[model samples]
Target: MRSLVLVGHGSHLNGDSAGAVYYYAELVRQQGIFAEVIEGYWKEEPSLRQVLKTSASTEVTVIPMFISEGYFTETVIPRELGLGHQGPVPEGGIARVIGGRTVRYTLPYGVHPKMQDVILARAREVLPDLDRPEVGRDTTLVVLGHGTTRNENSNKVIERNAAALRERGIFAEVHALYLDEDPKVGTWPERVGAKNVVIVPFFASEGWHTQETIPAELGLTGTATLFTDTPSGPQTVYYTKPVGTHPMIAEVILQLAAEASQARGGDLDRTHAESWRLLTRLAHGGLRVGEVLISPYSGLLELRHMLDEGRPTTDLLTYVTPEGLRDRVRQDDAGEYRPVRTFRTLPRGWRAVVDEADLRRALHYIYPAVVEETRAYTCHSLRATPWPTTARRQTGIYAKVQKASSAQVEAVAQKVCAACLRTRLWAAEPLGQTFFDGVPGGIPCAEACTYLVAAVRDELSAEKSPEKQDQAKLEQA
Candidate 1:
């Protein structure tokens, strides 16, 4: 058993980009694929450097969760991971000895054949639901990938998988579409020439491309719909989850490591023999498996034994709490404990109160998105149950605004909502068009940044005040 690091080129603009990898990592950890499974991003917290450093396993494997073997995998990741050149560990970047540990890197996840199986499995999930008996043999499956002019191979991988599916005679036809170049998504309806189409994204993860660009370009106002406009009679469209997240993905990762180890004259059966037990543990939710390795090297089990005593870093926030003041005490009363005060703010002219218990409950129930009648934003989705609505905002994890100006409270509510939105909680729904439609008050990125900046400004202003000046100086000293 060794350590596994799945790295992604995350996006600041689309929170789902990171969400995809994190969810997958959590699943992998739950399955116990490795003793230590970490999800690192280029844009978010726990950067590639930090993830690698924090991993306690002596033998480690790096898996590029990217959908392409282009710039990021060929150059950026190799240079960053110190995995050397396109061939071995010497041509790309620095190779330093860290904590007496040895690390190996593998190819991008998309290149693995097992991933092809994942694509097919995901396609099957949506195809059956969207397939029309009336459409019959005319139905087509469009396998969409975030094709790039910079990397023709990206589209090629998707196209190859489409061809494979077509060979199976599962669909009347299958085709590949790109986001960057021609054969675009808008042209899909024309190419398919079928009354029904099931579109499966070959992306490694979900993000803006899947949630925003793909939907708008394909004239899909909603997911899984039937359209009769494209000269193909009635067309039913269905979009499936990205290929990287399918349950079969873990098996693909194992296949890669097994094959790589065998190519080096290592016994594939011997290598996989130990992996079978690990895989079983993973299947049974083995998050605490001692010393797991997710790489392609020959010495995985030894590495696992070496890492036996090390504590896992996956419990980073097991006992974490939300930041900020939960209550404002202009006129404190001991009886307030019956419900307890919650933090709230007004969006327009509306003001509300949220009880403390209700606020705590909302942190769990209103996940991914929370609809509070007016505005909504992304938040770092918290896990808590939803409480009943008593004082408007008091029902959820947020109480109504009290003792503070409406502007001040609105700002706080917006921030809380934004955090929820980012965490995929908005109005008790994930704040994406694919999952939730008609977001009354859309949460734009600029507004989120403004709210964050304003919050910091207010905190600094309060700290600079005479009341807190002495306290701030003392802390600084």
Candidate 2:
């Protein structure tokens, strides 16, 4: 027997979050496609873990009822179900093993092509006269979704759907706006210029956003139609129900499950699995420089995996930033600092040394007479040695140095060594011996010594100059 599980992000405050999940699950049940159809929620009754165990069928297909392939669909759902190492799951994909059961996981409901039909249907219900030539020209279709700054990918589905809707020419124009991102709901009146506008919430359910936040933003008094004066003229705004609440959405879910079951026989793509494995490996041991951890965020792991497969990665460095590493550090519960195994060699002017002293100087130089110790540091070395004593005493720096140019790093190294020599902290003769002997193995020490010797040669040249001899004679006179 085969089982179907419809997973939804249920809300504790309202039952509406999981309302559509139950609606579609029942529809699938009545169709007799599987022996069992169960609805599960992250926050409501019949949790995913409980329902998976309760189902008697060895085969199951799990469909995520989300509008976008964002954090929840990619990371949270898979982790909770113990599927694919609890990471991002490919859209409309299969996970061959989950507690020894064959499982097919479909993409979120929002990105499916049929979702445009649901959107159009929602608009039609509000204004049955949309097909009328006069109404169609004056009317505009607006798709409202939750846009997040944290993950730009969340907006892709919404934007793509809006484009598709415009091509169909059901309305005069189509617009998409987000609650969390730019072109906010507050500016909808000014941005969407039409006498008759149909606004449809792209959310999965009619929760706080659709029922309260959206209505208040649009200044509606709980009525379906509201008249407001816009730049164009007097506009009639018709607010429709959420797309997920539409009963026709069940057909889309069924289609997704059927496709997943037939296309790959409930087996995850081998390439995707390999990519996940590489991500895990990099997370455990990869060269972390500056704000780049090369773990999962910033698409570094994906870039590496693609390169390994001989695929081109044009935008590998797009997501690499200092903030990405800070976020990862905050998430580390065990306080275990993973060693970096591979340093990403960037183009010219992107290389810098990661050292405790250099970072302290850089920070202090950037700030106004402030000297604060950092907890972690990252550096490149020719050979591995025991962790630095200073690092062990302090919190430790877990980042490699990044600069605008390699020349800048070399200049800093020379300046640092010269300062140490003048302060009597570094012995010139011993440092010179160490440099020539090459016993103390590490790129940092070798490179510093090279510049130190150059400084010495320049000093010797100045002492033997004729100008210096004349100055000595004048002082004697």
Candidate 3:
């Protein structure tokens, strides 16, 4: 079957790091163009290396939902897929035989010319006729990036997009600015030669750069500052959210994946089969993944959400479609955003069931690839990352968690992970904690999660603070 794995640079500290990817991936999944649509992240769960381990597609395309072509698009993503560029490169990207399967890797999603459409859409949200030369003559459009020397063409995308936008004559001036290098975004006041400025951040998601750093650099109070005081008299500043958030980008992904698929040489026979057909085999019998219970009785396959296996489905909210099920699981009973879907607080008394053909779509809406991965783990074909290695790979604010003593990790997991349903398989490995190899009939967590690591970092920082230590002593006394 055909499947697509969209990789993005997720954040350990911000749950919204991959929001755009997840949101659009779900949209694409609903379209059913690809048998399976899954997400892999460089900084989150279901890592890039193992994303395809449980997938059923023999012919798959790996597309990075990144806005630039550099270290990530050129090297990191391919290496994670074990491509190593050993074979001849194809039109879309490098076509490599990975895990004995021919997998096509597409270049980063940002290089296409169609991306200009999404940026223009974002601009229209503030100024309806921004595309018209009459209305855009006095406006300056800034295409921003974290420009670098990592690759010779590192700044090509932003520069190229900027040049293309300028050619459209939609704005008086278009400047490609970077945060990490010269002609930086912070120096826009002096670099951009226009009174009316509009900055469109070339990022895949809203996180540190889009939400914090960019706003700080531009001195924007909100999305639009009308006639604000600036170096060149009072000029209006309009800041559009990252283009990835625009609805049109999801359509962009569809075109890119379709293009890559056409370039791959594969046995088309049975390639169009639903990727979730694997779930149909177990439809006759019940299978459990963590707290989700899948049962077949009375000629109906029922997938229920509950805290305990002993609980009944009485008074539970029932949903029959994947979309409805996802909406329910994205939040806890308290109506707070439940970023980690496997948390023990998984709103109890909820049920979802679709035909056997759509079982994977429903299950993946909540648990992702957990069911298939669990089966692989049971068959001894899957291995969990050791706790130390899992901790060491954390980046950004969570990287400090690597310094956490084993005892500290144990204590933090006991508190933070105590409310999650995911079996901490890492806990059973070397240098691990007390013991939780996970019981049968539960989803296995191959590595530590952001939720647990954040808690560990907090506790470690608290212990390091003399004031917090004094307060702890006071409480104990």
Q: What lDDT does each candidate get?
A: 0.49, 0.56, 0.72
Candidate 2 residue runs with Cα over 4 Å from true position: 11-16, 85-88, 222-228, 263-477
User: What would the TM-scores of all predictions be?
Assistant: 0.51, 0.53, 0.76
Clashes of 1: 50
Query: In angstroms, what RMSD does candidate 1 have relative to the true structure?
Result: 19.5
lDDT of 3 at 172: 85
The TM-score that candidate 1 achieves is 0.51
Error of 2 at 96 (Å): 1.5
Per-residue lDDT of 1-477 in model 1, one digit per residue for the tens?
A: 466677887643444456566656656666665655666665443444335544435556667777656766766566545455553222121233443445656777677766666766776676653344454476688778787776666776787787887786667788887777777777876677776677878876556787788888777766577787767667778778878667677666665544433222211223223333333333233221111211111221111111322434342111121111111111123312211011111111111122332222122111111221112122332222222211132211122222234455445556555432232122244435421222332322212222232343465457558979888788999
Model 2, 1-477: lDDT tens digits are: 677888887653444455577668767777987766767665543444344544445678888888788777777677657675444556658566655567778788778889999999999999999999888998988898888886776788889999999998878999988898886766777776778888888988777888888888778765365565577777788889999889888889888888787633233333323433432454445423222222333432321221222223442323233223222322222443211111111121121222321222221111101111011001111222222221121211211222113443345535544332111112122122221111221112211222233333344455569998898899999
lDDT of 3: 0.72
**Candidate 3 segments exceeding 4 Å error:** 11-15, 43-45, 70-92, 130-133, 146-156, 168-170, 178-196, 206-238, 262-282, 285-287, 297-300, 306-314, 336-341, 388-463, 467-477
Q: What is the lDDT of residue 37 in candidate 2?
A: 70
Top lDDT hit: 3
